[model samples]
Target: MAEIQPVIEVCDLCKTYYMAGGLSQSVLKHISFTIYPGEFVAIMGHSGSGKSTLMNILGCLDRPTSGTYQLSGENVSDKDDEALAIVRGQKIGFVFQNFNLLMKRTIADNVSLPLIYQGVGDEERRQRAVEMLKKVGLEGYEDRLPSQISGGMQQRVAIARALINNPSIIFADEPTGNLDSKTSDEIMELFAKLNEHGITIVLVTHEDDVADYAKRMIKIMDGEKAYDGLRADYKENQGA
Candidate 1:
């Protein structure tokens, strides 16, 4: 059998921000990990724990100050903003807590927004958007405006948009932050279904309940990796 290549690899990753006064604060310190295809991994940390910064780097929205990030076997840690944008368009999908939909736009338009950047034709974009919406269980609502839908439904639209690109991985940052517990559970079940179908998902959240849906967890504390293992093990250790 052929060896499976990791979908993501980070080694000695470090991120530091220099203030205007020449003071520097490091956000991530020498963090390293590998994520294989089809894994549902949660990156857990408090507000100041640097998980957001790490997510930005992994999603190619920002670059690291030092070290390497290999996504699907390509080094993207040092790519310029334009290059990184291209990489993100081609390989990454992002789902955010705020839903991030344009209230004025139709659901189909919002779901197909990424394709507009790629210059896909209008009809094809609509067709693809409809297919993706169906995948997320929002099939007939494509003609509705984002403002017309409930928060969870809007999030489903966001997830549909994320899927339109057929990305190598999805980065979800506090994806359930805006929803109630019941709605959060629904959304998490959706993520679990996506993962079961071989979609690689990397979710970042501070809530243990939210992170519990993930098969594995990587916990960050004060800019350092505090734990990396199965989620069940982390829970067990915490109880011990």
Candidate 2:
């Protein structure tokens, strides 16, 4: 059998911010990891732990000051802004704590927004949006405005939007932060289902319960990797 290629590869990743008056703060310190296709991984840390900064770089929304990030075998760490945008549009999907939908737009329109950037025709975009919505258990919701739905349903719509582009990986940041426990579980279940179908998911959260849904966990503390291993093992070690 042929060896499976990693969907995401990071090596000695480092990020720093230079503020005014010549003060600079290092955010990520030589972070290294690899994520294979179809893996469900959670990145966890407290506020100011650099997890969010790592997420930003992994999602292609920002670049690391040094080190390498290869997405689906493409070196993206040094890519220009326009090139990064193209990489994100082609290879990544993002779900945020806030649904980030246009309240006035119909659900289908929001889900199909990425396709619009790719210049897909209206009819095709609608069809694809409907398909993605159905995948997220929101069939027949295409015409409804975001305001008409419950928070969980709005999150489902966001997941549908993330899937619209057929991305190789999805980066979810605090995806269940705003929902109640029941609704958060539902959203996590939806992510699990998506992962079962071979979609790679990288979830970022501070909540242990939410992180429990993922098979593997990578914990960051004070700009360094604190742990990187199976979630079950992490929990066991914690309990020991």
Candidate 3:
């Protein structure tokens, strides 16, 4: 079998912000990681540890101050806003903490948003969106408003929206943050199923249980990677 190229590769990734009060703050410092196709990885860090900054860069929501990033072999470090938008919409599937659904639109409409931005025809977009919704177990609730669904259901809709375009990687930032433990477990199971079917998943989370769902755990501290290894290793060393 041929070796799979990394779906994403980062080298010396850095992000720094200048405070209004004349102080420079570095959120990510020389961070590096690679995500292979079909791998499930979790990024874990404490508050202010640069996990979100790393996520923003990974999702194309922001650019690194200095470093190199390649997504599916395309250089993404210095892309302008418009080009970045195209890459984000086409290559990255983002699942946020708050679900980010449009209140005025129904589930189906929300799921079709990325395709709409891509200039897909209305009929085809709706068809694909509805099919994705069914895949996420929302077959009959296509027309329901986001407010009408429970949190977990809303997340399911979000996941369907993320998958509508068949992206190369799904970037989930605190995806289960708002759910109860049981609901979180269910969501993890859903993510596992998706990974089983060959979708690469990158989850940003702080909860140990949530991180455990991924096959690998990457821990960061003070804007630098403190640990990067298999989840099973972390589990074995939990009490050490």
Q: What is the C-alpha lDDT of each candidate?
A: 0.96, 0.96, 0.93
State, as a TM-score between 0 and 1, how close model 2 is to the true structure: 0.99
Model 1, which residues run further than 4 Å from truth? none
For residue 180, what is the lDDT in candidate 2? 98
Per-residue lDDT tens digits of candidate 3, residues 169-188? 99999999999989889898
* C-alpha TM-scores of all predictions: 0.99, 0.99, 0.97
RMSD each, Å: 0.7, 0.7, 1.0
Error of 3 at 66 (Å): 1.0
TM-score: the better of candidates 1 and 3: 1
Clashes of each: 0, 0, 0
lDDT per residue (tens digit) for residues 1-240 in model 1:
999999999999999999998999999999999999999999999899999999999999999999999999999998898999888888999999999999999999999999988889999999999999999999899999998989999999999999999999999999999999999999999999999999999999999999999999999999999999999999999999
Write down the lDDT that model 3 would get: 0.93
Q: How does candidate 2 score on lDDT?
A: 0.96
Candidate 1 local distance difference test against the native? 0.96
TM accuracy, model 1: 0.99
